[model samples]
Target chain A: MYGLIGKMRAARGQRDAVMDVLRETTGALPGCLSYVIAIDPVDADAIWVTEVWTDQASHKASLQLPEVQAAIAKARPFIAGFEFQVETRPVGGFGLPTAEPG
Target chain B: MYGLIGKMRAARGQRDAVMDVLRETTGALPGCLSYVIAIDPVDADAIWVTEVWTDQASHKASLQLPEVQAAIAKARPFIAGFEFQVETRPVGGFGLPTAEPG
Candidate 1:
């Protein structure tokens, strides 16, 4: 599976709002195994997003989806800038969404 | 829920070995909702661990479990050192472990 770990910084006092947009727009996407938005404890404005997908194509496809595009548009104003984006491969672990029967 | 995103550096040429131990020792942890091991794409020797738990106490308590302790011991030699550790609160997400029957 494909994985992405990225850090995003929100504008001052806008972290909650940014997360709200994320919550609204995320989920229900096919091929998404895991997608978590977390608050960075020390840096009040920083949020880390962890994502797991069945493959790279699936993740790329999600970005082109209307909901995700709307999320980016809605969240852009409150975002300061991204810190980093790292991609990886997930071999195995817990809490991954189970595969549905074909 | 409690979330942790950490970067661990492995000894030269030992990334797979380190991840191997992690895969063997990470699952079925009580209170652990997710524990994913991913390789940092840009850094050949670095790995990122993303974890979620039901609560802080449960996470802390797991450190004392024999399996966890054994994992630390078993993987230590191949570890270079931790780069960073960030704690986060997960307000909502996908692929988090569903609550078990009470």
Candidate 2:
């Protein structure tokens, strides 16, 4: 599986607002295994978004989805900056659902 | 549960070696729910370590464990630097075992 680990900084005091948009918009996406949104305890304006998709192609395809595109448009204004973004290969985990081979 | 999303940079060409140490050493820890280590596709020397613990106290306690200390000591040599570290609050997700209330 493919994974994305990244940090997004929200405009001052806007982290919760950004997270709400993320939660509301990430309802259903084809090939999405998991999409976790977390609050950064140390940096109030920072949030961590970790995603797992069936494959790189699935992840790439998600960007073109109307809902995803809308989400990006809606949340972009609150985003101040990004700290780091990394791609990963996920082996297996407890709560993650299995994905069909790509 | 408490979560940690962070990036660690290994010495040049040492990413795999560092991941091996992390996988070998993180066998069991009190209250540890998940510990995922992934390589950055774009940066060969960078690795993302995402952890989920039952609680803040449990996470703090882990640092004092002998095995954890040993693992840190063993892995420290290959560590080049940290990119970003963020603490998170995880509500729920697939594959993750439910953590007991703290």
Candidate 3:
């Protein structure tokens, strides 16, 4: 499985503004299976995102579009900087035990 | 599933040091079903982690332990900062569609 995980820092007091845009744009990305945003309790300005996507190609295509770029640009000012990682989990990767069918 | 997704910025030239500790300590986290660390290809010092845990209690306990604390301290110098999200996915949460048993 291919996924994107990353964190973005919101400008001193603009965290809420950034989050608003994230909530608005997530549903537009069809490739995204799950897109979650969370704030750090200890550091309020820190925002994190964990996303699972259909595949890298779809994700790459989504990023190249103008809509996504515009949303990112809107958030960039509030964000100090970001660190993120992209990875692929091999098929049958370990995690929650498979749920048994009822 | 209870998971932790976050990013940490490594101090200039210190990414490898932080990663080394992560690789070393993951097996010790029994609640952790998967612990992954990936570096942004575009930014060498940026590190991201996507983790899946058995539950929140187990994860909280792990964080309170001395070993984990010590590890965090060691990695802190290399890390500029972090933004992480902690979330729980309800049963049957979206994604991966379920694998068919052979």
Candidate 4:
């Protein structure tokens, strides 16, 4: 499985605007299985988006679409900058031998 | 399962310091099963932490411990602010019914 997470900042007063677009767009991504856009309850300005994709290549392909591009463009001005982190691993499902505390 | 995510900003140049403490402390939390601290590769000032705890009670109890308090005190100055988002759900497992794209 491949996961892509983006941590971004929304322009002052624009966080909800970006999330609205994201909610509208994510459900349609061809390879997106699970996607979450979580806003920090304490910091109204922070946003963290998590996406679980089938694979890295599929994810890269979706990023090329016109809609995706447009969404990014619309949201870019509101964003100060963002960090993208990607990880791929064989997740044997959740609760897999819960790690014992030391 | 109870999951708590905190998105915080590190004071200029103190990101590493906070992460260092988190890494050291998480392993000892009696109820912590999985903990991940991901730094935005694009935004050096942002940090997102994801933790899976056995339950809320267990998690709350840990916060009261002396070591945890000290760590929080030491890191507080380095934090600009943070938002906490908590969710509890029976996460049956991962990769469940990979959602189909519309």
Best model number under lDDT? 1
- List the candidate numbers ranked by DockQ, top first: 1, 2, 3, 4
User: What ranking emerges by lDDT with the best candidate at the front?
Assistant: 1, 2, 3, 4
lDDT per residue as tens, model 2, B3-102: 9888899999888778878777665578877776667777788888778888989999989988879989998999999997778997554445672211
**Tens digit of per-residue lDDT, candidate 4, span B1-102:** 555655678998898887777656665477765455556566676676655566678889989998889889888888877754444321322322222222
Which segments of candidate 4 are over 4 A away from where they belong?
A: A1-102, B83-90, B94-102
DockQ for every model comes to: 0.48, 0.26, 0.09, 0.09
| Candidate 1 backbone collisions, by pair | none
Docking class of 1: acceptable
Which window of ten consecutive residues has the lowest lDDT sum in model 3 chain B?
B93-102
How much does candidate 2 score in TM-score? 0.73
TM-score of 3: 0.49
lDDT for position A39 in model 4: 65
Specify the CAPRI tier of model 4. Answer: incorrect
What is the lDDT for B23 in model 1?
87
Per-residue CA lDDT of candidate 2, range A1-102, in tens? 899888889999898778878877665588887777778777788888788888999999999999889989999999999987778986543345572211
Model 1 lDDT per residue over B26-56, tens place: 7778999988888877789998888899999
Weakest 10 consecutive residues, lDDT, candidate 2 chain B? B93-102
Best by DockQ, which number? Answer: 1
Residue B18 in candidate 1 has what lDDT?
Answer: 93
Candidate order (TM-score): 1, 2, 4, 3
Q: Model 4 residue A6 lDDT?
A: 55
